[model samples]
Target: MPKLIEMMKPWQWMLYIFFWALFVTSIDRHDLATWPQFFVKFLSRIVQYTLSIIPSLYLIDYLRPIFKRDNPINVSMKILLLFAITSAVSATLVMLVMINTGWLVYERKAFVLNVLFNIVITVGFTLVFMLYFIRRYRELIALKQSFEHKLTAQNDLIKARIAPHFFFNTVNSLVSLIESNPPKAADLLQHVSALFRATFDGAREISFEEEVELCEHYLAIESSRLGDKLVVNWNLPDDDVMYDMVITALTLQSVLEKMLLNVVEMTTETIFIDITIEWHQHRVTITVTVQLPSKTLMIVHDLRRHVNFYIQAERLRAYFDQSADIQSDVTNEQIVTVINYPLYDVSI
Candidate 1:
């Protein structure tokens, strides 16, 4: 519960509360025959969960320091205090329900005992839920931290590589073009500025238009440096649809960058990098195929290892959950990388 507070958005917390309450209420009932019987209890539990859990969340968070104490006495005291708060809330709410639903008209002693038992069972369920949420929350925290760390590392790697890999060559190209082709040099400067802007951007999702724009800038700069040696072919969908989708900024560009960097020597007349994007069902499939260089030159390690395949897949998972994936097929003459991520209806 403490860990859950650290990560959950307000709506997400509500979802957890509502679902857990519904599950507990469903399992607690013995006579589950009629819709009327089930719904009355269902609505009540939902209300109780919504009301009781909201205040309890605040209190538990405030008392988290004490809850973490390892001393047995402190542990016992915390548990007692939490149970008392939750049970007290549950008892009050249930009494309101009984009064309204005519359950309070039953025999006095039996009613009191039944209410007591209900409070005990409900409070017991709350404690179990706390444990479950705590475990799940910690796991979530670990995964989020890992993803952030990887992004930071990759960002730093790009920063380190920029100067050595592209800047020097770009500078030389600018110097040569400054007098010979002033307009082309100005265009190169524009692309360079865009390159730097995209490179230093914090790890976040951006519209496909933004990513494509960045890729265009990058490809332009690379083309300037590589001259006629590099050729990029793009087969894409309509502008309206493409612009609506969002993906991790720099991710596809990184894959293209890796493809170029991995080319030690060109076996063919010109190195061709083909990018193809298609939509099927609710998912977008993007395939990048780069012609192979010489066997010996390409015998080298994959440059994409910096942002490994698994890391790319995880990035997609962050956006589309388990529906997204990134994979590659390596043939004798081409390395075909395929990335698939579901597009939400609204995104289209």
Candidate 2:
């Protein structure tokens, strides 16, 4: 339901409420004195119901996380209970409004089936919501699958990175450097530990500074192993404020690792990677361009690896949804990937 609420646009909400408001008004149109009264009632109900529904929408969204792990049976029962309570409260408020507005003559008899009328209205309103929920069924299922698949991919990638030639090579390098340069080796070991911790941190988001630090740690370890085979050119803003912005966890780490891995696998030649960070109109764009070797372009370009990396990268996209995305351009010479994401609610 949180996902559902998150996915729905403002226009969708307006359309949804407007449709149900008309349905509720129509149910009472038969009792109106004339067509003019019916129209008047519909307009009034639109204003009143829209105002009333806003709070309920917020309440439902607020309660979503609490009920997220509940069983289907419990969820269904809870939904029914909430609807009943909302209807009863709305009915009481409507009755009071009618009395004060001179729409109803105040009397005990005036109460006349108010609860029943509200029950009927609730049924119609609930249907409207159910219909909208049903309409988002495809997207909800896709999102669920993406999350499940992402978890599997992340675990697999983490396992591969943690227990491989790269990890072994870094360890080997650390061992040799321990006697030669104890301080440098210790720093390298710390970076390795921090890199591993960053990946498994279980954080949904982290500051841009942390992300950049992770990237540098990654490159440091890689530089130790690959030596002159890897070259990274960093282009960044002079302003420190941009680094205070936030990005989804591993948003840059995963992609940069994958890109570096792709190049490392193909050749022992010097691989050039340029990473640039820019801030414009309250948005942050990080661009990474990896230069491909002539031999690799002619010999092999593994599409499957790129596709897997893309799938993994898609996980971070869910954080901003429409406000952010990652894009890439592949050519004969290089693959240029740009990660564009917005920064808001940030204090620096």
Candidate 3:
């Protein structure tokens, strides 16, 4: 009964109550002589209808699992049959009460007609309500699938942009490494090859731990090239908040690579890059802060534009159903990039 009430919309409940009122009024209109009698009959009918319909609805709910195993046509037939049987029992009980209370005649013909009318009304209401609810459910499902498809397309575009951007930078780093340290260049190639293979495995989402590992590898390759000029700091929480949570693939790595590349381009001196990960209120936040020289203050705008373009923050928002938030702030001393997304635990 609670499930039935929850499943019904406000207007649906109103319509259901209205139908019962109309049914009762139609059957007892001849008895309504005065205002007092009308009120009494209406109130009595409301109680009677409630008593009858609640059990019928409860029976339908109880039988839903069994009905679902059958085909649609069979399910409809079984529901109609159930409604017919329950309505017959309810009408017989109402007739007994009406006759005993001197509200109805004791003729066989009148009693038969009353039971038939009750069956018709109850079955008709059940069929109409079921059809309307099923149609609306299908419509909602279709809309959800359509929205998901659009999000997938947008994520694919973002993935395409990230892969080439990271590849180009890694290749450039390899070039520099080959000139200075041939052995490290070969090792970087092996790492880059493994990263490339993982990227093409066609995974739309990845675990937070896996994403952080990818970022670390990318930073390692870059660190080899830049040496002492680049300083990387990681501050990851020791808790299990991020253990099962998943986000779009390449999300963390793309932001980290983009920010570091921008910092390297804007400064020739040593730069400190701080990466912090924390969990708050079912959300995972990644903050990357890079200490920038005062002379490169004007480069913030260019960095913002590049990060927004390559990271596709808006696309991430859509992919995560608007649960992702990405923002950038630049000061004279540092550039801060913050990415927050709901911790979607697949295990749950």
Candidate 4:
């Protein structure tokens, strides 16, 4: 149902009901004042019910097509046509019933008054419906704009994070091998160059599956540096749900990189990062959960504040109108981020 129709005043429904009652009463107003009158009223009511219910059913079925545009002129014309057809059909049924049973009554002034009232009622309902629709339409536009703005902000934030992340990981790799072996440090320098090239090569948006590959590449670089200290787990379906769906340019890559940065900065134990994806009827769910360092939680209080992962979540919501949530337990031993996004259908 259109928002306008759903918000109609009780008086509007009463007006429709009154039209049906008036048709029944008017058709049986004279002549045989007994069973014939009752029969005329009953028969008129039957016609009224048919005309009212069938059109409403058809209208409901075809409502999506009708609400394609929000122009007042077009909407008003459509509403008027619908009401006029229904009113005319009801009037005709009443007139036919009156003539059949020899109870016909016609006063020109009263007939004109009745029609004018019906027009007034129809116009009132149409005006209210349009008012509500226009309000909702404007709201949706504002929402879309707000979302676009957030996406732009998030893109900048991701770009800023990229440079620092790249430098940190590269420096960390070299720093780890500084005193141990000159030959190993030389190899680390090569890995750093390749990692930087891979990380900052392009700013193109990729599909979900592609993002996963990029994430794995980043993790691979980190693993080579961290050795057995880092652990990564993936739980993804074996379908094109990931490959066929588009995500923000390097969105998953940035997130995975961010998680790794936090892990490397804080944790030395076997840090486990789990990534999972699921597809439902209307949405795709992505979950990222990681083990928290023992002392870092005490130092930073809330590590989410330090990394600004919440900003990424807000950015995702702005673009998708889906929900993104992060939760940490009271013990602060783990942090979990879950994102739900509407499935983009590109098959057509």
TM-score per model over all chains: 0.60, 0.66, 0.62, 0.55
Worst 10 residues of 3 by lDDT: 309-318
lDDT of candidate 3 over 1-348, digit per residue (tens): 124555777577656766686666767577567876666556655655666666766777877777667898987788788778877887788768878998766999877987787788778877887787678768767876776677566656655865776778788988888999899899899878766665665436677788887777777877776778788899987757667666767777777767776777556788888999887767778898888865545455666666663334654665575767778887767778888877655455
Which consecutive 10 residues in model 4 have the weakest lDDT in total?
A: 322-331
**Which one is best on lDDT?**
1
Candidate 1 Cα misplacement greater than 4 A, ranges: 1-120, 263-268, 279-282, 292-325, 341-348
Model 4 root-mean-square deviation: 8.1
- Put down candidate 1 lDDT per residue, 1-348, tens digits, no spaces: 334356568889778767766786687677557777677767766776666666666777777776676674666457546655676667566766777778445566755665566567656766776577657868878988897888777667656766686778789989989999999999999999987887787667888888888999988987886777788899988987786778887778878877766662234357888999887787888899988765345542453443246656776777566878888777667788998998875743
- The parts of candidate 3 lying over 4 Å away from their true place are 1-149, 163-165, 175-186, 295-297, 309-311, 344-348
Going through the candidates in the order shown, the clash numbers are 0, 0, 0, 0
Alpha-carbon local distance difference test for all models: 0.73, 0.71, 0.72, 0.63
Please identify which of the two predictions, 1 or 4, would achieve the higher lDDT against the true structure. Answer: 1
Over the full model, what C-alpha lDDT does candidate 4 score relative to the true structure? 0.63
Clashing pairs in 3: none
Q: Quick one: RMSD of model 1?
A: 9.1
- Which runs of model 2 end up more than 4 angstroms from their true locations? 1-22, 29-31, 58-146, 200-205, 226-231, 236-244, 248-251, 258-272, 279-284, 291-308, 318-327, 330-334, 341-348
lDDT score, candidate 3: 0.72
Q: What is the lDDT of residue 227 in candidate 3?
A: 75
Candidate 3, residue 31: the lDDT equals 50
- Per-residue accuracy of model 2 over 155-252 as CA lDDT, tens digit each: 56665765586677788999989999899898899899988887666536677788888889988987877789888898877656755677776677
